[model samples]
Target: MKIAILVEGATERAFKKKLCEFLQSHLGQKMPRLHFITQDGPIPKERKLKKLVETLLDNNGYHAVIALTDVYTGKPDFKDANDAKEKMRIWVDNNPNFYPHTASHDFEAWLLPYWTTIQKLAKHNLSAPSGSGSPETVNHQKPPSYWIKEIFRTGKRGKDYNKVIDGMAILKNNDLMIAINACPELKAFVYRIISLCEEDKIIS
Candidate 1:
């Protein structure tokens, strides 16, 4: 199987790499091929992205095409997350192999549930001000990336967390079950990917 993933940034690319590796291990198959395309920054222009997707599908022999973008960046063509998703759904309509997944707030929101583990690993003394690391609470008031940066800046570490450098390490060490339970959006995306794998008989 061949898969194409269009992502917004380096951190997402790293996370997808880990996710694909996990899927391969779980499926016990090395046959599934993954291709990553970086959008360089947040995807704000829906029409441009649609055109890009069209070109990719026209040129590539991918079994599946998945688009992952953060909802916090605000798309120019849509008023809100629901609107954006609906538009994307329409764009992908009848394209059985295409899937669109949006990360609420930002990619860092997925990591918020595992903040405690990250703090421990980074040896940072920062604590969640709300005393809870739930995604809903943590991602409610601020962009998840900003929230994470605040923790790193205020803590003993003093150094900013580099998503590209540290994100995969943190994800690798943390328990995925905790993330799945804490983040509904993430869980849904994971389930979709797994379902696709099973549907294609990549995993039995």
Candidate 2:
């Protein structure tokens, strides 16, 4: 199977690479041919996503297309995460082959609930305290990237957190089940991917 993922930027690209690996390994399925979207075109920010999806679907090779963008990226039309997702859903027009998932505030919010897992994986003390409340509610004040950097900077070794390197490492090494349970948005995205795999007979 082939799947195209339209992500906001490099951080998301890294995250999706790890996520695809996790899904393939855990579900015992052959990994899909994954395509990452780029921003080299002249399309406007708001319309760029739809254009990418349309282009991917037009190729006729991809079985599924998923768009992942952060809610806090300042899309003027969206009032909040739900608004952004709803707009994308309408734009997708009930197409089964296309799915839209938004990371509330930012993608890093998904990591807040797994502080202990991160600490263990990095073998360093995290400076940020464990957050509480719903995933969106808990860390809406700052981007997850900021918090992660702070955690690494204040650790015993005082290392800097590289989004592409350390972020992907943390994601790969951490407990997938724990992350799925803690983050509702992530759970929804993963569930959709699993369902798609099942529907395609890639996994039973």
* lDDT winner: 1
Single out the weakest 10-residue window by summed lDDT for candidate 2: 38-47
Q: After superposition, how far is residue 11 of candidate 1 from its true place, in Å?
A: 1.4
Q: What RMSD value applies to candidate 1? A: 3.1
Best by TM-score: 1
Q: How do the residues 56-118 of candidate 1 rate in per-residue lDDT, one tens digit apiece? A: 777877777777777777434544456656777676553666677777767887787777776
Off by over 4 Å in 2: 38-46, 74-77, 92-96, 120-133, 200-204
Query: Where is the poorest 10-residue window by lDDT in model 1?
Result: 131-140
For candidate 2, the TM-score is: 0.79
Task: Give candidate 1's whole-model lDDT.
Answer: 0.69
lDDT of 2 by residue, 31-140 (tens): 56677774422112446556657677886678888877677764455567688777786775656677878777677777777677567655577555445335554444
- Alpha carbon deviation, residue 165, candidate 1 (Å): 1.0
Task: Give every collision pair in model 1.
Answer: none
